[model samples]
Target: MNKSELISVCISDNRVCPMPPQWVKFEELLSEMGNGKPPQSLILGYWFDTSDEEKRKCVQQQIDWAYERGLLDFAIEYLTQLKPNQWHTGYRK
Candidate 1:
C-alpha cells in the first residue's frame, strides 16, 4: 500500500497513523531530542529504555485494534484462501 492508503488503514483500523503507538512516541522522541529529552541523556548509565515498553504496548494495542476492527478472522480467512494443497495419508499398491 502506498503512504496514503497506509495512512487510511492506520487511521481507520488503528485509530492513529502507523497504528503502533511507539512509532508515534518514537517520532515524539526524535522531535524532542533536539530539545533535550534524548534517551541517552535520560538513562545516562542505565540500559532501560521506554522504546521497548512502548513497542510492547504498541503490539498489544495493535492486537486489540485488529480485534476491534474485526480484521483477525478476515486476515485468517484471507490467508486460508491461499492454503496450499492438503494431503491425506494414502498409498497405492
Candidate 2:
C-alpha cells in the first residue's frame, strides 16, 4: 500500500487507549496529530517500535468502532482469519 494512503503514525504516542474513560485521551492524541475530524477512509497505521500488546489494542479499538456502527460483518471475516502477529504490521508476512 502507498505510504501516503496510510494514516501517519506517531511512535511517541503509540499506545492505543481503550474505550470508555480513555477514549477521550485517544481523541486528544488524534486531535494533536491533526486528525480531529473523522477520516474519509479507514484510518490505519502501524509501527515496529510499539509493543505487541499495543498493536492488539489498536486493532481491538477498530473492531469496537466498527461493531458500534453495526458494521462488524465488514471486518470480522478478514480479521478473524489472521494470526495474532499478522495484525501487528501494515504489510503481509
In terms of TM-score, the best-performing candidate is 2
Model 1 — which ten-residue stretch has the worst lDDT?
Answer: 82-91
Give the alpha-carbon lDDT of every model: 0.33, 0.37
RMSD of each candidate relative to the true structure: 16.3, 13.4
Quote the RMSD, in angstroms, for model 1. Answer: 16.3
Alpha-carbon deviation at 74 in model 1, angstroms: 5.5
Backbone clash total for model 2 is: 0
Q: Write the per-residue lDDT of candidate 1 for residues 5-93, one digit (tens) a residue.
A: 43234333223212223334433544343333322211222213434334334433433443444444432332223212211111232
- Tens-place lDDT per residue, model 2, 52-81, is 455545545554554455445544443334
TM-score of each: 0.27, 0.39
